[model samples]
Target: MAENHEHGKMDITEQEKTFEGFVKASIWVAGVAIGILVFLAIFNS
Candidate 1:
């Protein structure tokens, strides 16, 4: 049996963070848009 121990460093850049935030915001915005459309359709019918 052999065992190995190793670790790697990870870092996130500002651009990556901003992009992640943008992705999250867009997802929420899309979800809200869908909900609104559904509400309008049901409300009018």
Candidate 2:
């Protein structure tokens, strides 16, 4: 029915937003981890 189609669209939109947020967070974490490793190498050397 039309109602089910509308609900499915809403669910898809919500999932997309959640996935985008997760990707952004993962990138930030990776950047921070790399920064820390570089700093450690510099300090140890």
Candidate 3:
């Protein structure tokens, strides 16, 4: 039973790390997309 609890905690920690990584990646992607859009607008205008 204790082993199972420990395993569960490990799983949760891994999941949290994965989620944080995804969030960071998404923010980077969004920033790049916004930068591209702004550049295009300036160039087109």
Quick one: best lDDT, which candidate?
2
Tell me which of candidates 1 and 2 scores higher on lDDT: 2
Q: Which ten residues in a row have the lowest lDDT in candidate 3?
A: 2-11
lDDT of 2 by residue, 1-45 (tens): 765565434547878899999999999999999999999999988
Residue-level lDDT tens digits of model 3 in 1-45: 655565434547878899999999999999999999999999987
Give the RMSD in angstroms, all C-alphas superposed, for model 1. Answer: 5.5
Q: How do the residues 1-45 of candidate 1 rate in per-residue lDDT, one tens digit apiece?
A: 224533433355877999999999999999999999999999998
| Total backbone clashes of candidate 2, pairs 3 or more residues apart or in separate chains | 0
Lowest-scoring 10 consecutive residues by lDDT in candidate 1?
A: 1-10
Residue 32 of candidate 3: its Cα lDDT? 100
Clashing pairs in 2: none
Q: Which candidate, 1 or 2, has the higher TM-score?
A: 2
- Model 3 TM: 0.73
Candidate 3 global CA lDDT score: 0.87
Output the lDDT of residue 33, model 1.
Answer: 100
What TM-score would every model get versus the actual structure? 0.70, 0.73, 0.73
